[model samples]
Target: MKIPHKAHVALVDGERFLFLRNDGQIFDPKLSKVEEPDLEATNFSAGVKHQDQGGQISGSTDLNELAHAAAAAEWLNAKALANAFDELVVVADPKTLGEMRRHYHKELEKRLVGEVDKALTHEPLEKIGEVLANA
Candidate 1:
């Protein structure tokens, strides 16, 4: 597969796994596009610490959380788009759609944070705008 020179970040938040493709055109995560996979649960048992908090958790656990959040966000997006696509079955699912949106976003939030962290891990403390400039 031809991986683009573009940078990408993959991570699991609550109940979802997210893949962010960086186009280097926007600041921070402004124009980043995210793809999420349907995950099982939040069970980080891999001993990842919570940022100098003295607690450790597993990667699995963290992934679960990300999945859930991502699913919630998907639900919300579906709802907002529901009215636009009256012909689609998903558009008719108002309640389920809402739940999915919230879940999708909840899960994605963690993943987004992780993605950003990884991208900046080796950086020399620069604003997201600097990265976008490379585009």
Candidate 2:
């Protein structure tokens, strides 16, 4: 998973998210933190259907966390609609990734370069770069 130069990288989880940019070359990425857009949790009631997946969303044990993940996906969708970045990579926990997948806008899908289903939100920037370089 070589991160293209200046590519936007989002490391997200249910509770935390880090926005970064790769300033170096594809194989040797220098990740620099970037300010994230103001994000608000989406309020979803229990049993709401997922239109794209054609599945009922049963209540999660951690409803708040699920809402937060939905919020992250919404933010990403908004960014995609705005053409905020040309290339995007997502590194998120499995649950968050799945939630995001259900809500991804077509534009976001086009710009997405890679996704890693792991919880990397808390990892240091250097560690994240290393992992991505080897991915």
Candidate 3:
């Protein structure tokens, strides 16, 4: 995950998000913090319950968290449609990544540089850069 210079990096989870830009070189990347987007909750999965992979009943998932992830995905979709960023790298928890992937626009898919399936939303900028550098 050597992020290209100027690539937009989106670190997101159900409850939080941190946007960043790679201001340094590809190998020695410097992730500069970017402002949070003006996003509105889509609430698409507000009350949804996920079935277990085994098709068996399990404890219910957090409805609010699901909705939040959906909202983040919605925002990304809008940005993609508007061609907001030329290169995009998504770093999210596995569940959140799945939600975002479900809503990816074709244009966004084209711009996507990479995806890291881990929750880095609250990680420090240096840690994030290190993880991406080693990924």
The TM-scores, one per candidate, come to 0.26, 0.85, 0.86
What is the C-alpha local distance difference test score of each model? Answer: 0.34, 0.80, 0.80
Residue-level lDDT tens digits of model 3 in 1-135: 679999989888878877789998897789998877655666746435464443234534655556677777777778778877889899998887887787777888898999999888788899999999988
- Candidate 1 stretches greater than 4 Å from native: 1-5, 25-30, 41-135
Measured with C-alpha atoms, the lDDT of residue 55 in candidate 3 is 29
lDDT tens digits by residue: candidate 2, 63-114: 5566777777778888779988899999998877887787788998999999
What does candidate 1 score on TM?
0.26
The reply for model 2, stretches above 4 Å from the true place, is 45-60
| Winner by lDDT between candidate 2 and candidate 1 | 2
Q: What lDDT is reached at residue 8 by model 3?
A: 89
Candidate 2: clashing pairs of residues: none
lDDT by residue (1-135, candidate 1, tens digit) is 111334444432333344445454334433243554554434333223322333224332333343354454454335334432111111112222333334443333323222122223233223332443332
